[model samples]
Target: MNDQPAADTARRLTTQEAARALGVKPATVYAYVSRGRLTNRRDPVGRGSTFDAGEVEALALRSRREAAAPAGELSVRTSLTLIEDDRYWFRGVDAVELASRYPYEEVAEWLWTGGPRPGARFTAPPEALAAARRAVAALPEHSGPVDRLRVAVAAAAVTDPLRFDLSEEAVLGSARSLVPTLAGALLELGAPAGDGAPVARELWSRLTAADPEPRALEVLDLALGLLTDHDLAASTLAVRVAASARAHPYAAVSAGLGALEGPLHGAAGRLAHRMLVEVLERGGAAPVVAEYLRAGRAVPGLGHRLYRGEDPRAGALFGRLADLPQAAPALAAARDVTAVMARHGLHANVDLALAVLTVSCGMRAEAGETVFAVARTAGWIAHALEEYQERPLRMRPSGQYQGPRPPQPLP
Candidate 1:
């Protein structure tokens, strides 16, 4: 064996060498250092910064892994929605065009059956609605809308004897009942019963006590249609996973509801709503944005990963909100936040638009999240129906083992 120190044997690379290994420029290597994605140490011979060769190689490997298809990433075939060029399509038609012209129920029916059922309306079965309401009422008085929704879904599931039938027709039947059950169950404790209005009208009653204006009600309906589905979102993935295991539609929806509790997912709108309120209170977006930056929190409602430009959903909603006199202030606040964030290449997202609606309508901060859950229920059901058509357990992915070898002595 060579008589050499371990430290001496460890290879070190100059900045240029590290950059070459990483397939990036020297400045990019330093940029990586600044981002805490890589580390550098001063060269012992005063040749500027040096990187551990092992670390550089590891980073290169990681970069390649990230640039390529991620390990265990599954490619699911879906015909329901397509997102490209910063715009989305549902069943080969422009989603914005479809949502703007059609009621939410019609759009949802089209998503499920691949054909427009114009003038479609979803009404909850009396028994299912009653069961859901009872379950929602049992929750703690302070329970948020999403919490009530989850409980309501579970109770509604108990009342459906045909929930186990995985046939497309039966699943569609459950979806029609479940979506309205979710909305009807959230009726405010003392609110009057719905008069069989559209889903948005019924939902509006629960979200705020203010009477629904004609234009505002239109915006709400448009929002429900726009939010009906996005291909393979986190909650939809959860629903698909549950469905892959042969879970009933109700259980699959519950899994999706559970996934929505994450702040990065369904709760993002609530953060945006609170930020808008703060901007209104402070009289400007500058201070609120500065505080968010100082606290290292991403200013919510500013960017979306899928869209490099303006979010189409935000663009659509903002276009309509401009027509409402009452929405002017909140709309201005959203624009101010967008203008401030534009310097960083961020644009307003749907959450900001939804916040504008909730804020202007006298709704609470959580109202956006409530709207998201109720709207996304249609999406979860769509994904569940798709999953049910695939082979059972098709989504199960084998784990990449990284632990010590099994031959090691038992601990």
Candidate 2:
């Protein structure tokens, strides 16, 4: 063995060399230094910093070690939408403001194809609506709303002969028709097409078991607009994964719906709804919340990973419920829950607001999820469209193997 200092043996690299070693760009190397993730020493005779190869290698190993799941440390570039600093933005427009001011279709138009023109009103063809209705009815009574929606999408896809046309115009045209069609079918609205009413109003008429009030209708519209898109969610990732394979929009949307069906993603609304019911029945938020914590279960709808404070969408939706006289009790229970969470430094999320909307409108327990799926369809289409422009099949991530090595021959 040769005697040598550890520093003398450790290799040093320029910024660019370090980037290559890390399998990233030079800017990323700088970023790693700025984030204090890697150490950088100033170049003795030149401009930029130099990285210790050992440190860079250590960082790469740590990155791999920490990323235990598919979701860990993955980043994708997109100009479609953003969720940062507790604010959601679609093409730089504030989503909270757009939800209160504009229709969801308009929001979808901006997401799918960037332009100044507002999209045409969403109207479904009679045949497509009929096809979707049959699909929804065929589902078992135990099926969730998302299940019916998923089946309806598949059924509609089978009915459209031109669904293979993956052109942007064709795909967008289908999306515009499909979302409203799915909503109408779920509500069983048998009205003629081209009626001059907001799509949310039509949906509200079907979802609310009681008489539809203006305030409730407004809340539905706002909710739809706010939920239209979120950046790189699980369902959106599924949509992009399918789209990267050059799948047709319908197939891509089906993939999204499939991913969204899980309880952790789209079905959080149902859990939140159940929690609200328990809170209201127990006469306050504390007892039910206490029981949930004692059992080591998280309080559904009480917190989100993204938002540092309250979810802005939750704030927007819940604030509007105040004007409606019918939403008083549900709203009160929701506030109680928020208050209890606040003491522990947790905040309410959009799921809680959606649960409040579900209960206050006298809709079924799964209505919030249905609304979420329908609204998120716009975002899926947007993501698919964006993915179509990218090099196909680029989402293939490298797998790190941990299995045992090949056995020795004749062992």
Candidate 3:
């Protein structure tokens, strides 16, 4: 006999009805189908697809549960960063202001320690760089930069006999070396590595072969600093989870990199990059934006949940990009996309701004993701450092089991 619920006999809902039940756009309903989150069948009586009402309700419930916090939600105290009033701060100082004024290395140093450490520089140890390069080089040719970075971190860890040391100084030491090692491991585009150069400069060499314009380089450095940290982001939380398990700093960073693989996270910029490129090719944003909606996909790089207005990082970058003559077309494209999205009450986010930078710089679409991974490494280490001081396994959260309660009969 079938074990199916009685609701299976209920009438099915059309795609529009399903989207309404789920409180999402009709396109998003299709996106759910594409992502395997929901299933649909073509309606014999109509052109549109139909979803089982029971299945749609179940999926909607699941989405709600995932989006809402669980009972007894976990919270952690941090001195690293704060977000409030549509602005963010690092250790109580205005983050955007700090990023605007200092170089990437200095801002990173300030995050890791209280001091700005003006003129700070990070150089990867030769042995660590060599090991990271060897491991990264062994990855499949199809591997993305973040994939290579994950391998590079693990390889660099193997070379550090003292990787297990959880002390702040040792973790800081590991962080300084690891960031650059990750940069050095990527297959360089064309720009030569500069010895003792800022992290932004070193990363530029890897992301593209285009000769660096001074103003463009400055914008890149600012981007790095702006992206250094923003409270407990998904990847930063992953780093803390690993650190709470007493994993080595390298391992914690590896955990963060793993979280970065998700499309909703690190890969968002790449999506925005491709979208902007398409806008340029099509000579307008209207058709491109409509196509995204038509495809049941959200226009990426728009509407950050955290900020009700514009994303401060995007604003900052846009202000600087306006100064670069070469970035004019791409920058205009970004503005056009935002204007189109504005009709839907969405605004540009940092991913959109980063896309403009990558497009104008002649870098590949994935270049923004690479920049994010490198810059956020410092923030991850900072979070790891904070977690190291907390009680062991403090990050573990209890599950609220909603599955079968007791055994009734054997299957």
Which ranges in model 3 have alpha carbons more than 4 Å from their true place?
A: 1-72, 407-411
* Candidate no. 3 TM-score: 0.82
Q: Residues 274-387, candidate 3, lDDT per residue (tens digit)?
A: 999999999999999999999999998999888999999999999999999989999999999999888799999999999999999999999999999999999999998877
How many backbone overlaps does candidate 1 show? 0
lDDT of 2 by residue, 1-411 (tens): 125455744577888888777766676576566436787777657888777788888977765554433634555557778888999898888989977887778878877777644555888777887999888887787988778888888888887887888767888889988888777777443333246456786677566656667778889888998999989899999999999898888899999999987778988888889999999999999999999899999888877888889999999998898887878999899899888888778898999999999998888778888888889999899888777754466676767778777785765
* Between candidates 2 and 3, the lDDT winner: 3
Q: What is the C-alpha lDDT of each candidate?
A: 0.87, 0.81, 0.88
> lDDT of candidate 3?
0.88
Where does model 1 exceed 4 Å of error? 1-71, 189-193
Error of 3 at 144 (Å): 0.9
CA deviation > 4 Å runs, candidate 2: 1-74, 116-119, 187-197, 407-411
Each prediction's Cα RMSD?
Answer: 17.7, 10.6, 19.4
Best by lDDT: 3
* Pairs of colliding residues, candidate 2: none
The per-prediction tally of clashing pairs is 0, 0, 0
